[model samples]
Target chain A: MSCWETIADYGLRSIGIGERLLPRSDFTLCQQFTLIGSGLIWNIYFGTFALLFGFFLATALAVGKAAKSPFIRKPSEWFIFVFRGSPLFIQFFFAYFLFLSLKSVSPVFDPFTAAWLGALIVLFLNTAAYSGEIFHGALMSVPKGEVEAADAFGMSGFTKFRRVIWPTMLRLAWPAYTNEAIFLFHATTLVFFSGFPAWQQRGDALYYASYFADKTFNPFVPYPILAGYFILLTLAIIGVFGLVNRRLNRHLPDAQKGRMKFRPNVIR
Target chain B: MFSFCTDPQSLDGLPWLACYLTTGKHMAFYASFGTVLILLAITAPVALAFGFLGATAARARFRPLAWLGKGYIAIVRGVPDIAFFLFFVIALDQAFEWIRHKIKCPDWDQPIRQGNDFVVCPAAKLPLSTSPQIWHEIYGFFLAVLTFAIVYGAFSANVLYGAMRAVPKAQLETAEAYGMTPRQTFWRILVPQMWIYALPGLSNLWMILIKATPLLFLLGVEDIVYWARELGAAKQARFSDYPHGDWRMWYFLALLIFYLAFTKLSEVVLARVTARLSHGQATLGGTGRSAAP
Candidate 1:
């Protein structure tokens, strides 16, 4: 079949859209690219949704963690500790199993078996803990002067936090937060490999890459393509985060402002 | 392990639990924890050395050498490490045998890549095809270690390079003014000062290395995850002493707890190390004060 015809067939294969069966024999480069690209849709979905929801949760976690009251601080600390302390791989497995166990009793909770729900839940919690820690640190490091300025303007507690502290905390945390986002994107690859089944072979980029690798017995080709896709994704994240970082640092003098230096490395 | 434990089905509650936990497969599962520690122990220093070499190469005067080092670090950093673990094991195995084919059988004209098979002479096989079973396991483990080292070494290189640059220019200038050679200045001033800066990144890298241990399953090694799944699957009562339901979740939960505890301990130790490293340094950790970066 022609490459365009092949693309049409496998373009939505990962979502169980076009192709019922994957290319089994005579594996083509076009098939690997199209299929893996399709699979990337899942990764983007997981990363995007988790990040969006995780952001607000993380803000709350950060504030709670920074709170003087033990009631608020303790749970935040423990939550961060539990999520950040465990491996994401094991987290995926444990969450999957927990979700599975939960599903046995309640059909209302059936969504956790699906990657959209299961993987997203894990990613959300994971990112919240990580971004929470980042924000906590940034909150602590919020300049004494900034707080004083807010206080002089009759700002206190909620008002102070809303206007001055939150923006600065987010600004300082953005770079590190950007790193966490990239890692989360990469961590999406583990969803299918963990206890969560791919659900009709609807897997991520790594899944499709592995499929091609196993079929051709050639890791060289497929993995590189997947790597290229991830690099592009990472670069895109850096670009977007860099723009945000620029806006956050816009107030500072050029000399004092920190450029968004790229430090692309994984915790796992 | 006790005589009474011989009959697992007859035991109740704690006794059954003790017997179950002490079973042979459980022992193997427990030993896989050691496998993780060993991987961490071996990979960390090796990766550091690789990183040092990489950084030095990248800093080298030669253009090609610098590009090679830069390229290695960049590519490894860019890709998901799972991809590296999956790809490198096969690639390295094939490359090793292909090289051996060239050396051991120079007269052979057959291509190494023939259809789906990678045909090297039997003599050219890694572990020599006649080595002991332990040799094969060790070889597989060694390959996993190399892949870990290659990937993590790049990360460490990034950290070390930044640490190296972070060493104050004044200290190097002072050493140069004192007539110390470049090498002496580097060893005495740069290396020592870089440690304080490098410690945080290196410690973070250590935690990551700890977490990456489960990827041993992907490399075809029977790591704890593999063992967990193997032992936790449903078993017929006739064939197995401890027949169980699909308890893979519980096994994985236990693994999760194991990792959580390990990472917590590492965090405590790393925090202490940072505190120690900060002492007497000009940086914020000095004088028992926390410095914000």
Candidate 2:
């Protein structure tokens, strides 16, 4: 079949669109590329949504961790510690079983057993913990002069945080947060490999790559394709984050601006 | 195991719990933790050695050698490491066998790649295909260790390269003024001073290495994750002495707690080491003074 036909057949295959059954035998390069690219839709989906939602929680967690009240601070500290300290692979396994038991308890949680939701929740909590730590560090290092200047302008409490503290914290944290974002996208590959089942052969890029490897017994082809797709993803993340980074540092002169450095954290 | 633990069916309360915990599978499960520790113990120093070599080469004057080192460091940065883990296991196995195939079956002319199958001569088979199961496990483990070292070696190389550059230029120039050779200057001045800068990154890598132990399951070494899944499945009364419902959540919980404690202890020890290393140095962590001082 032509590459165009293969794309038509499997373009949206990962989300259960177009073709129902995956190509069984005599796999073409187009088939591998199309199917693995289709699987990347899931990776993008999980990474985008988890990061969007996790950002807010991460900010809240950072603020709470910095709070003076022990009640608020202790829980945030422990939450970050527990999530950050453990392996995300184990967290996925434990969360799946936890959700399975909850499903047994009631029908309300039935959707929680599926990878789309279950694994997303695990990634959400995991990224939030790591990003929260990054933000907490930034928040602690926000210059004392900035807060005082805000107070001098009659700013206090939430107003001071919103106008002065929040922006500075983000500006300080963006470099490391960008690193976290990149690694979080990479971590999404572990979803299908972990305990959660990918229903109806719908899996992520790594999943489809592994499937092709299992079929062809050739690791050389599919893995490099997956790596190519991820490189593009990483580049795209850097572009977007770099734009925000420029905006964050817009007030400063170019020499003083913090550039987004791509320091790859190999694993979570 | 208590004296009355012989019959699990008759036992109840704490006695039943105690007997169940002491099952043969539980022993293997416990031993698997040792596998993770051993992996860390072995991989850390070996990966550091690889990193030191990579960093040294990256800093070399020859352009090709520097490119080779830079390429090695950059390879792991763009891809998910799980891909590396999965890829290297199969790739390394084939590479090993392919060399053996060429050497052992030099007279044979059949193509090795025969439509989706890697058909090496039986003589070229890893572990000989007739060797004991233990040999297979060891061979698999050796591949895992190598893969871990390769991937993490890149990360450590990046850290050490940056740390090498972070050492003060004057320190090396002083050694040159004293008529020391470049090699001697590097060994005496650069390497010693780089450690203070490298400690924070290396400690971070160490934590990452600790957390990554779970991926050993994917490489098929029967590590903790494997045992947790195997032992935690619901057991029927007809199957064995221990009958229980699905307890995988609890098993994984135990694994989680173990990692948390391990990481926590490492953090404490690393902090102390950092403090000790920072002493008498001129950086912020050292004497709380500016570099100018």
Candidate 3:
């Protein structure tokens, strides 16, 4: 098939919308690029949705963990521990099987079998646990003088937290939070590889890259294409997070504003 | 394992459970846990060595060497590690065979890439295609280890680079004032002190390495995930001696418990190590000595 024809037929092949058969021979570069790029949609979807939703949960968890009351603090601490302690791969398997068993009795929760809800739940919980730990660290490390100043100004309870505590927590947490976001995006590649079935060959970027490698017995082209896309994606995440970090630190003096540093070993 | 275990149908209740858990395949399943642990043990040191080398190169005076090292660390961090795992296994396999092909089949004219097949001469095959089954398994495990090392090494390089920077500048300068060479300062003053700062990152890396053991399944190694899936798949009542319904959920649950216990143990040990490393050092853990109040 011509390159254009190949594109038309197989562009949406991952979602089971187009060609049934993958290109078996004479695998074109265009085919590799287009399919892998198309598969990236799933990665972006999982990452974006998970990060966005995980942010709120993480904040709550951080706050809960930092709270003085054991009732509020204990569960959040356990949540963070359980999720962070286990591997995301095992989490995926555990969550998938757990969901599958739950689905056996209740059709209402069957969406767990599909990536739309199931994998997203796993990613959500996983990132929440990670970001929760980061935020907890930041919350604890929030300057004592800032809270003292807020109290001196007669701020108490919700007002103190709203005006002083939360913002500082976020500001201190942003850099590590940014790292967590980037890695969580990267971790989305593990979804299909885990117990969660990719139903109808519908998989993510790594999936399509593997597909091309399997078909052509050539790992050179397709994998690099995926890697390049991910590099761009990582940069994009860094850029967006940098902007937020800037806003978070806008009130601080130039020398005091902690620059966002990317740390890789943040407990993937 | 016992005479009564020969006929599972004759066993009842806890006895059936005992025999079922002691089956030959169950033994293999248990051995897979050892495979996971062995992988972690082997990959950690290999990846750390690679990381140390990469960190050294990145900080080297030579621009080209530094750039190459920096690039290795950057590219690996930027891409998802699963992508690297998928890519490297195939790429490395091809690379090794290509070298073997060049050395062994010098007079052959046919191209190695024929359509989708990578047709190397018989001698160039990774396990010679006729090697014993253990050799194939070992070869697969080796590729898995290499892939893990290449990826995790980049992470370690990042940590070590930061740790190297964190080592007090004055300490090295003091070494220089004592008439030590630059190399001696690095070894004598820098490497020893860097560990105090590097321990946290290294511990974190160790936890990540433990977590990454599951990716071995993706690379086609018969690790726990593979065993879980194989043993948990539904069997028919017709001819199968070990017929069971779809019990993958239970099998995977067991695997989850295994991992949780393993990670908990790692966390305890790493905590102790961090405390030990922090002793006499000016770090957070050092100041909070004898555990937090």
Candidate 4:
């Protein structure tokens, strides 16, 4: 079959579209690229949604961790500690079994056993914990002068935080947060490998890559293809986050602006 | 484990629980925690050595050597490390056998890559294929350690390289003015001072290395995750002495708690070490009143 036909067949195979069965034998490079690229859709889906939702929770977590009330602060601190301290690979397994038990308890939670929802929830919580810590550090380091300037202008409470504190906290946190975002995307590869089952042979990029590797017994091709796709994805993340970072530091002189360096934190 | 615990069905209450916890599989499960600790103990210093070499090579004056160092550091930047873990185990095994094949079976003319099979002479087989199962496990584990070292070496190299650059330039210049060679200056001035900057990153890497121990399951090493899954599956009455519904959630919970305690302890120890290392230095940690400025 032609490469175009192969792409047409397996391009959307990861999401259960276009084709039902994956290519079985005589695997071509086109088949590998198309299937693995298809699997990347799931990675993008998990990364995008988790990051969008996790950002708000992370902000809330940062704020709560910085709160004066012990009731609020203690839970935030413990939550961050527990999530951040444990391996995300273990988190996926633990959350899977937890959801499985929950499913046994209630039929409403049946969907929670699936990777799309269940693994997403795990990733969301995991990223939120790490990002919350980064934001907490940034929040703590927000210059005293910045808050003082806001108070001198009669700003207090929410206004002070919204206008002065939040922006600077984000500006300080963006570089590290960008690294967290990259690692979170990388962590998404662990979803299928963990307890969550990939429904109907539809798995993420690494899953498909592993499938190809298992079939061909050649680790060279599929993994590098997966890596190439991820490199593109990483570049895309850097570009987008770099734009937000530029905007965050727009008020600063060029010399004072914080450049977004790609400090790769290997794992979450 | 107890005298009266002969029959699990007849037993009840705490006695049954105690007996259940002492199963043979539970012992292996407990031992696997030692496996993780052993991996950390071995991989940390080895990876640091790799990092030091990589950082030094990157700082080398020769163009090709610097590129080699930079390339090693860049390989892990964008790729998911699980890919490397999965890739290296197989790739390294093949490479080792292929080299052995060239040396051992020099007269053989058959192509090594026949379709999907990587055929090497039996002499080239890792652990000889007839070796005991323990040898296989050890060989698998050795590859895992190497892969971990390689991936983490890159991360540490990045940290060490930055730390090397962060050392005050004047300190190195003063060492040079004192007629010390570049190598002497690097050994005396740069290596000693870079640790303070490198400590934070290395500590972070150490925590990452701790958390990454679970990936051993993927490499087929029968680590904690493997044992947890194996032991926590629901057991039927016919299957074994103890029959229970799925208890994997609890097993994983215990594992989670173990990791949390380990990381917390490491954090405390690392904080103390940072303070100790910061002493007498001009940095904020040194000048701060807590350290006898």
TM-score of chain B of each: 0.94, 0.97, 0.95, 0.97
Q: What residue pairs clash in candidate 1, if any at all?
A: none
Best by lDDT: 2
Q: Cα miss at A119, model 2 (Å)?
A: 0.8
Candidate 2 per-residue lDDT over residues B1-293, each given as its tens digit: 67888878898888899889988889999999999999999999999999999999999999999999998898766788999999999999999999999999998888988878989999999989899999999999999999999999999999999999999999889999999999999999999889989888898899899999999999999999999999999999999798889999999999999999999999888888888878878888887421110
How far is A65's C-alpha from truth in model 2 (Å)? Answer: 0.8
Model 4, B136-169: lDDT tens per residue?
A: 9999999999989998999899999999999999
| Model number with the top DockQ | 2
**Every model's DockQ, to 2 decimals?**
0.62, 0.82, 0.74, 0.80
Candidate structures ordered by TM-score, highest first: 2, 4, 3, 1
Query: Which model, 2 or 3, shows the larger DockQ?
Result: 2
Model 1 residue A67 lDDT score: 87
* lDDT (Cα, 0-100) at B229 in candidate 1: 86
lDDT of 3 at A198: 81
- lDDT per residue (tens digit) for residues B151-206 in model 1: 88988888888788888889899999999998898788888789888887788888
Give one digit per residue, the lDDT tens place, for model 1 in A143-229.
Answer: 999999999999998999998999999888888888888888888888888878888888999999998887777778899999999
True contacts kept of each: 0.57, 0.78, 0.75, 0.70
Q: lDDT values of the candidates? A: 0.85, 0.92, 0.87, 0.91
Count steric clashes of candidate 3. 0
Write model 4 residue lDDT over A1-268, tens digit each, in one string.
8999988889999989898988888888999999999999999999999999999999999999999999999999999999999999999999999999999899999999999999999999889988998899899999998899999999998999899999999999999899999999999999999999999999999999999988888899999999999999999999999999999999999999998887765366
Report, to 2 decimal places, the DockQ of model 3. 0.74
Q: What fraction of the native interface does candidate 1 get right in terms of contacts?
A: 0.57
